[model samples]
Target: MILSTLDLNPVIDLTDEQFYQLCQANPEVKFERNANGTLVIMSPTGGETGNRNFEIGADFAIWNRQTQLGICFDSSTGFRLPNGAQRSPDIAWIKQSRWQALTPAQRERFPPIAPDFVLELLSPSDTLPASQTKMQEYINNGVQLGWLIERKTRTVQIYRPGKPVETLNNPSQLSGEAILPGFTLDMSLVW
Candidate 1:
């Protein structure tokens, strides 16, 4: 199923702590907060999408283990962006230095920083426009590199700071570039 968003305008606004509690209470549900405070409730992905997400996360994890240059996170980790949005990318990475800057307490909660690199894998239920908008948000909030992979079309949208969005069609692999030197994602498993 597609994701659903709720705008709780008439109701009292939920404080960050309250949101955290709510999330903790509902462990089975996936939630996100937009910069404007809209609550997004996303359903669990289908089996195929879940498997793809696992494969993508595993690839990043292996690369991270080899390089030790950064920490990789799976979809379940939430990050509080500078713009006040709480986002959980399908796959995310933060530089070791940036991660080390956070205190132990901060690391235990949703990190209040943008990820250096993010990857969003599009499931069949996801809309292209919505995914593109999310990528733009990530870029605007200081994400240096972002990838929106659309399995349906075999297309990848690459987002880089201060650069126009680049589109690749059916690419066999994606380079991590300077941001993640010596890292490459094999598209065979993802596609």
Candidate 2:
């Protein structure tokens, strides 16, 4: 969905604690913060986007459950990236070792670590440029792999560290590669 940015610069810049508290106070809303502390309020997705997201998330959840090699997180999970931006991808996965390294408190809150893999599914109100920018931000913050899926265009933009993005058109499936071995996403469910 299209995001609305709230600039709380001179008025009152929200500190990390304040942002966390704001999120806590409004449990029904989804929020994200950029490196510059600009608050991004995300709109709720339509039914089609929600269904596709759930299907994709379920695929990742099942893979992670079987592999037990990492932790899978849904859209509700927020992460504090190295760049100091708090983001919540449509789906996220972090290596088991990395997740275990965090303390209980860290795990309980928005974990201060980037996910190894992230996926963003474009909704009707979502813009391709915005999604691409978000994916690049993920890579800059040490995300190993990211996928920006635009269902309307039947395209996938793959992001990786130090590598140019690879676009796939109407692929039958997507492989997890080295990041998520033995995992494959069924495009049928996404379509």
Using lDDT, give the best candidate's number.
Answer: 2
Report the number of the highest-TM-score candidate: 2
- Looking at model 1, report the run of 10 residues with the lowest lDDT sum: 1-10
Write model 1 residue lDDT over 1-191, tens digit each, in one string: 24789888469688778888889999999999999889999778889999999988888899899989999998889999999889999999999999999999888989988999999998878888888989999999999999999998899999999999999999999999999899899999988
The global C-alpha lDDT for each of the candidates, from Candidate 1 onward, is: 0.91, 0.93
What TM-score do all the candidates reach, one by one? 0.97, 0.98
What local lDDT score does residue 112 receive in model 1, on the 0 to 100 scale? 89
Runs in model 2 deviating more than 4 A are none
* Local accuracy of candidate 2 as per-residue lDDT tens digits, 34-140: 99899989999999999999999898998889999999999899999999899999999999999999999999989999999999999998888888999999999
Q: Give candidates' CA RMSD values in order.
A: 1.0, 0.8
What's the lDDT of the predicted structure labeled candidate 2?
A: 0.93
Model 2 Cα displacement at 59 (Å)?
Answer: 1.1
Task: Check candidate 1 and list the clashing pairs.
Answer: none
Quote the lDDT for 88 in model 2: 95
Worst ten-residue run, lDDT, model 2? 1-10
For every model shown, the clashing-pair count is 0, 0
